[model samples]
Target chain A: MIITNIETVPGRTIVEHYGIVQGSTVRAKHVGVDCVAGCQNTFGGELKGYSQLLEESRNEAMDRMIKQAQQLGANAIVNVRFGTSMITQGASEILAYGTAVRLE
Target chain B: MADFLFFVVFVTAVFFIGQHIQKKHFASLEAREQALLYLPAVVGRKVFNDDDVERAWLVHGTVVVSGDYFKMMLAGLIKFFGGRISAYESLLDRSRREALLRMKEAAASEGAHMVVNVRFETSKIDGGNPSQQTTGMFEMLTYGTAIRLKAQ
Candidate 1:
């Protein structure tokens, strides 16, 4: 399904609305990754491992949302948004939500 | 005594190194922004007419940045005093600008002329360590719809 974080997908008109669809996942850093991140904190720079981990989680959440949208027969998702929360010491919950719509 | 001595030395070293790195990063961000000024990234939901648009797609950029020890320590002190933590402000500012720059770069690489409905998501990724206050790591993600207009 096509996805855009806007009210309407460019070059397309929405014909049907599937309401709101959402997907979420919780991810924890591996011990090795945590060790690497600790080093990053001490030395001060981009935390590559954490960035990768969050990016993967976000993609997974988006995929799940897309699957739901597809089940609703929607061809596109609009006004998508992302939310994040720290669930525990090392785990975070990533949520992706959007309005699924059919475009013509 | 030795522990305190090492802590002092580490903070001093990080202070200088962090300043240098931040200066370099700011310089680079300025140059890259100048290079990408042709592309307009706006937060409006409006899109160009279909006749004038060739294609549109989603694009995003994510960055995870951590503050140096010196800044973290400074933030901690400011926190205790309940005042504005300027040290951390720069950290957030840099990451946000960097994230937006990356999104713009992505759009440019796709030959897009404009980006719309830009959104930002900021999260602290401190490994959830209870002492995360001092870790001062944040992840900034910027996403938008990139529109490539038809050539006139």
Candidate 2:
């Protein structure tokens, strides 16, 4: 499917509007990679382990969101948004959401 | 002298073992999952507005150390092989799942079906500190258009 951060795909026209679609997942430090994170404590040029964990979580949520849209019969989705939060002392949650729509 | 030598050997062995496990596990899991998409022309012809779309989705997920025994085994195999590529694959699979689910929900709300020309992105959060172990994690984001296919 045509996925983009932009509200609309360049040449396509939206026909119908689906309310809102979302997918989310929660993760904990014990289940994640062993690495140090946060902007304040990063070593020189090395990539932090937490950063990698967040990336993985984000992708999983996006995939689920797309699958749901397809099942709803939407040809495309618009106005997509992403969010992150600390669910517990050592865990985090990632969410993906957008409006499903039919195109001309 | 013998004590010092043993310590060096022990440390080296631990490092190698950790690297090995990481390689083995990542490779197995990454290979098992693949991203698939279905885009039909009827849905493709619609003229969609970028701004009308409104929001940009940020999809994310994690396998975690505590869940899925099978996945943990796979990760261990990946670690055995060496390199950090396995980590990327793990995150990629998760991001794809999230993006698709969100798209489906959007389509349902609009009373439409199907999404076309799906796109994906991957990035490292770079929390910065290598010494800090509790706050590190990777992030992935996938975005795409949700549309209704024309009726036959």
**Residue range with the least summed lDDT across 10 consecutive positions in model 2 chain B:** B59-68
Best by DockQ: 1
Q: What fraction of the reference structure's interface contacts does model 1 contain?
A: 0.62
List each candidate's DockQ score.
Answer: 0.60, 0.10
- The i-RMS of every model, in angstroms, reads 1.9, 11.2
Q: What share of the true interface contacts does each candidate keep?
A: 0.62, 0.07
**Candidate 2, DockQ to 2 decimals?**
0.10
A3-97 in candidate 1: lDDT tens per residue?
A: 88877766678999999999999998889987887776765667888888888998899999999999999999988888888877667898999
Docking class of 2: incorrect
Residue A17 alpha-carbon offset, candidate 2, angstroms? 0.9
After superposition, which runs of candidate 2 have C-alpha atoms over 4 Å from their true positions? A35-48, B1-152
- Candidate 2 residue A86 C-alpha distance from true site, Å: 0.9
